[model samples]
Target: MTPTVQSLDHLVLTVADLNVTLAFYTEVLGMRAERFTPADGSQRWALRFGSQKINLHQAGAEFLPKAARPTTGSADLCFLSDTPLADWQAHLDALKISPEEGPVRRSGAEGPILSLYLRDPDGTLIELSNRL
Candidate 1:
């Protein structure tokens, strides 16, 4: 038998404010929303980020007793770009993204990783890193 392999299709995140999240993804992150639709005709919305995506379901579903609220800091998500760290920093500057910190070197990563830490509209921490 052989192990079947597949690429990561997407990542789903539940957000409290769909509009804010969508704006951040589009404006700050410079990602296009490939799809947007309301599920069940409510506040729930689906947003796509490149190949990954996040579903912002309304707060009151049976499974979700509460809406997906923002966290104190940071999401467990990391996005890598082919652009060099210096170039990424310039991009951020051009967009006025205002990173909390970094374009600093990450030691434990496999190679020379330049990273910038920032928060999304939901206060979800995001790390943008590139291997040099």
Candidate 2:
């Protein structure tokens, strides 16, 4: 028998500026930014949505057990929303954010999804999607 994998809880994002990272996630993507004190007695920031979260680490001050080579602007992540794609487009339009490419169909982890591609302040590719 093999161990069964359930789901993801969190991942980490190495950022250059904590304030900018927190703001982008919380304001642009509609995520919530939170601070927590871990066992090490240090405060850390995280961006959370639904049941998932992404811990933020300063590029030069990361926690132990980090990636072998952590770098900013290296991650390409996709996020899902219950809101329709058209609504997402409007939201982006209101924000004055341009899409690199999008309103295109792609295969999601579960099924089909329509997505919009954009870049964050750190140049990380961020995908906003709707499950179809």
Top lDDT model: 2
Candidate 1 Cα lDDT to native: 0.66
Q: Across residues 10-94, which tens digit of lDDT does each residue of candidate 2 receive?
A: 9999999999998888878999999999999989999989989899999999999899999999999999999887887888889
Residue pairs that clash (backbone atoms under 3 angstroms), model 2: none
Please identify model 1 stretches exceeding 4 Å from their true place.
1-7, 36-44, 58-74, 107-112
lDDT of 1 by residue, 1-132 (tens): 999977776545656565777787777777765544345454445556567765654333312443355232235667777777677678778978788889788743466677888887767778888876
Worst 10 residues of 2 by lDDT: 83-92
State TM-scores per candidate.
0.67, 0.96
> What clash count goes with each model?
2, 0
Superposition TM-score, candidate 1 onto the true structure? 0.67
lDDT at position 48, candidate 2: 85
In angstroms, how far off is 43's CA in candidate 1?
A: 9.0
Task: For model 1, give the RMSD to the true fold.
Answer: 4.3
Candidate lDDT (C-alpha), each: 0.66, 0.92
